[model samples]
Target: MSDATSARCVKCWVHGRVQGVGFRYTTQHEAQKLGLTGYARNLDDGSVEVVACGEGEQVEKLLAWLKAGGPRSASVEKVLTEPSQGDPTWTSFKIRY
Candidate 1:
């Protein structure tokens, strides 16, 4: 299947200065711009967790963005990504509280 038509989901944990830096909001914005669906939220361990589901290429783009560094205020030190295991149910990207 083409990258544009294939569906995929990736769960990423962004570490290092991700919290308190508008990381979730920025991730939501980026996901929306890429037409991906899922959620971003602050984790208890001072990291930001993101679940991106959509076309394979879009998901990869989000991963790349996470690895390259997030929002201007965010100092991304590491990004860990894995294939999401659960069903893809999100219809829109959101910043979860």
Candidate 2:
């Protein structure tokens, strides 16, 4: 099956100075570099939404990278784990906006 909107996944809301600092792009790079498929987008609430739709060991690596404050310009103070229903039409990691 394709990596559809209902893929097994982990969601995260990366907080603190995350926007406008290439967080989405950096995340896309990370995800793709790891041979994973997902999407990263900016939330209006000053946070970035990320999803890694796979398994624990693999997905957690992405989550760990996020919790570690992705990309230098973005000062990630906290990463909020959220429930994910996955996303639309994304075959590989990408920036949503």
Candidate 3:
């Protein structure tokens, strides 16, 4: 395993009522608060995809928060998590196009 593998990185696909909402912003805020680094983007399928990396516990906490959906106006129906590739350095979380 590489050093990247030693660090915890979680890739998640969040579906249901996530787009057109503040989910991305809220997710960024939450991830930053947890000291995690990642990016969130709106998918063409109307879902939100996120990739977060940090300490094991912190990454898990970020995933859990995403599972609960974001702030008001967003309804997260499902959250699918998986391992990501490479070690992407994120200075700050942002919404991707």
Candidate 4:
């Protein structure tokens, strides 16, 4: 129950034991389930970067999930988010290598 104006985007830098634990892939799955479009990748600093764009409520849901420790394998310590206008052109979520 949303319109185009309800769409939003955010960028998150997740810290902790995120990389090497299927974090990016798990994020893709979660984003897809929420009908979000964006990418997740492992940063050189051992953090996971995720950019999600979709309905405001769904995006918020994804943020909560990410903050709550993401996948079972991930030990998310902290997640920093910002209002970054992610690529709405991406029709699906993906794990950037």
Q: Estimate each model's TM-score.
A: 0.92, 0.82, 0.86, 0.93
Per-residue error for 20 in candidate 4, Å, reads 0.7
Residue 66 miss distance in model 4 (angstroms): 0.4
TM-score of 3: 0.86
Sort order, TM-score high to low: 4, 1, 3, 2
Candidate maximizing lDDT: 4
lDDT of 2 at 40: 88
lDDT of 3 by residue, 6-79 (tens): 56888999999998888898888888898777789999999999998887778877877877767678998999
Alpha carbon deviation, residue 71, candidate 2 (Å): 0.5
lDDT of model number 4: 0.92
Query: Model 1 compared with the native: what TM-score?
Result: 0.92
lDDT of 2 by residue, 1-97 (tens): 4443224677888889999998998998888876677888999999998887764456777888988889999999999887576665657887777
Best-fitting candidate, scored by TM-score: 4
Backbone atom clashes (below 3 Å) for every candidate: 0, 0, 0, 0
What value does the lDDT take at residue 12 in candidate 1? Answer: 90
Give a tens-digit lDDT track for model 1, residues 34-87: 999989989899999898998998999999999999899999999998888535
Question: Which residue pairs in candidate 2 collide?
Answer: none
Worst 10 residues of 3 by lDDT: 85-94
Each model's C-alpha lDDT?
A: 0.88, 0.81, 0.82, 0.92
Candidate order by lDDT, decreasing, is: 4, 1, 3, 2
